[model samples]
Target: MTKIAVLGAGSWGTALANTAAENGHDVRLWTHNLNQVEEINQQHTNSKYLPHATLVDTLVATNDMFLAIENVEIVLSVVPTKAVREVAKKLATALEEQAHTVILAHATKGLEQGSYKRISEMIAEEVPEAYRSALVVISGPSHAEDVIKHDLTAVSIGSSDESAAKLLQKALSNETFRAYTNHDLLGSELFAALKNIVAIASGALIGLGYGVNAQAALLTRSLVEMRDLGAAMGAKPETLYELAGIGDLIVTGMSPNSRNYRAGLGLGKGKSLQQVTEEMGMVIEGVNTTKAVYDFSKMYHVDMPITSAVYQVLYENKPLRTAVADLMARPLKSED
Candidate 1:
């Protein structure tokens, strides 16, 4: 069994830690929250984020960043996008000696706003460049709750290093969980990050009492937008059709449990962005990703009418009806 370290005590992190333990690895889950560490260690539960089930008895929790990093062969980072750099800096500081020996897999999905860099690129910047060679992106449609329940799930392990991706596949793959490898690291992360924006759009439709037709339209258009933006950013066009793309978009857009979807529902119900954020209490990644993608779309000269509409509604305080009208009035173009 390999030694696995999971940073972040959030639902996804806890669930992944459980998966690693169930895979018979020695699991060390790290969090900044001492109370959460204590809860995981004492009660085998992460009450705030994942209250539905208990963790494996073999799973270990620690507030010490070094303890979490020390001796682990692979580190899985499941923190939010914004925290990726800060956590990597901390990990870097803690693992000056062990950096080369470890493989780092980041599961968070979002782009850095100004740089428009994928999270993998952000990690490449924050962590030592030498360690960047070992960086891999772990992503798919697997939700934390479903994964913990042992529902069948598949993920893509993207890296320039095929061996590193294969290593993760061996470490993470199981009867209920499978891992696929790809060299499209940036493309994988791009769709994964951008889809949350579309999910918010879907939730907004539901909140606005739009029917399935509206949801379907939103999903289709968003897929196009996602592909267009990804293409502009150097991602393969076909990558948008894969699990990290259409597959992820479908699940997040439809599920009530999706934090971004719930946030969009609030907007659809006529709540302010601040109000929705306050109510969710969890990080609604779509809010930030929408802002990032808006800038990206403009910078890349990509046409994303649906994303533009949502951005206007959220940031410019344009009425939802007005945004819809604006979208409807856009010039017609080929559906290619």
Candidate 2:
């Protein structure tokens, strides 16, 4: 069985570790929280994150960062986007001899603000350059809650190296869990990061009591805008229509469990962004990705009207209805 190191104890991380263990892989699920480590090791559960879920008996959890990376061939990074670089750096220092020994697969789905660097870029900066070529990103419409329940899911795996992607495809795929491989790492990552912004916009529409038509229009337009921006940024145009883009957009925007969409709902219901974020108690990725998209659009000179309007509503205290009106009033352009 493959040895897997999951570098997070959140719901997604726990779910993936459980999946690996159930597939008969040895997993060392690492968390910064010692109490969570104890919960997984002693009780075989992560009640805080996955309340109704049970961990596989072979799954181990630990707070010792070094122990988590020891002799593992696959390092699955499931931490938040903001913490990715810091965690990767720590992993690098802790596993110097094993630097190029393990394959790093990350599932974070947001861009770095100001720099607009994707998670893979951040991982490349933190990990040794020799090992950077082995970095991979796994993304799709799968939600942590659903995945923990073993619900059927399809995910995409992308990497610069075709062999690495194929390896992950074999390691993570099952009859219920389907995996597809692509060499368009940048496109996959770009879609994963940008889809969150569209989800926020979709959520805002729902919160405003707008009907399905408006949500559908916003989602379609936002996706086209994402492709336009991704094209300018060297991504494959066709990738935006695939799982990482359209697939993730549909699920995250419409699903009630999406924290990003829920945060937008609160904003649409007249709650301040600060209040919504404070209540969520988790990182609403779209909030952070909004700023990233705003900056990236300017950097790429792509006209993303919806993203701009959503950002203004969230960050500039612009009223949601007013922003919608502004977007609607913009000059019409050819739908080329």
Candidate 3:
């Protein structure tokens, strides 16, 4: 059995740890909170994140980062975007002291602020060269809630190194969970981050009383925006149409379980951004991603009206109805 270390006690981390343990791997789950560590080890439950789910008995938890990463073959970084760099630096130090290199994989989705680097890129930048092996990105339409239920879920693993992608695919694939490998890491990461922005807009539309017809149209246009931006950044055009792209957009935009969608719904219903974030009690990745994409679009000169509209509503205090009107009032143009 392979040794696996999962950094973060969030729903996604816990679920992944459970999956690995069920597959008979030696799994170590790490969290900063000692209480969470106790809960996972003693009760096999992470009540704060996965309220209804019970983790596998063999999956262990630790509050110490060194203990978690000790002698592990794989390290799965599942922390938030804001915390990625710090965790990567720590992991690098830990791995530097180890005798062997470990495979690095991250499931966190979102672009870093200021630098605006993707999660995988940020990890590579922070991790020391000797401690790291092939870096891979694991992302798709699957949600933590569904994954814990052992719902049939499919996700894509992207890496420039084909063997790395294949290794992770073998490690994660099971009867209930499927993993597909792809070479277009850029396209997969871009689509994964940008789709959350569209989901927020989708939730806003639903809150504004727009019907399925409107939602469908908005999603189609959003796909175009995603493709345009990804292509300009050197991603393959067809990759944006794959499971990591359009498939993720559809699921995130339409599902109530999506935090970004729920946050947008709050905004559309006249609540402030602060109110939405406070009520959800979880990181609304789309909120920050909207700002990052807005800045990136300005820098890259990409045309993204819907993303800009969401940005205005979220950041500029533009009334939700006014943002909708602005979007509808755009000069007529042929569909490209």
- The lDDT per prediction is 0.85, 0.85, 0.88
What's the TM-score of every candidate structure? 0.96, 0.96, 0.97
Candidates 1 and 3 compared by TM-score, better number: 3
Model 3: lDDT to the true structure: 0.88
Residue 257 lDDT, candidate 1, scale 0-100? 75
Residue 309 lDDT in model 3? 94
At residue 258, what lDDT does model 2 achieve? 79
lDDT of 1: 0.85
Q: Pairing residues by index, what is the TM-score of model 1?
A: 0.96
Model 3: residues with Cα > 4 Å off, grouped in runs: none
Best by TM-score: 3
lDDT of 2 by residue, 149-246 (tens): 88999988988888888877777787778888887889989888888887777777888899799988888888778888989999887777788778
Ranking by TM-score: 3, 2, 1
How far residue 168's Cα lies from its native spot in candidate 1, in Å, is 1.2
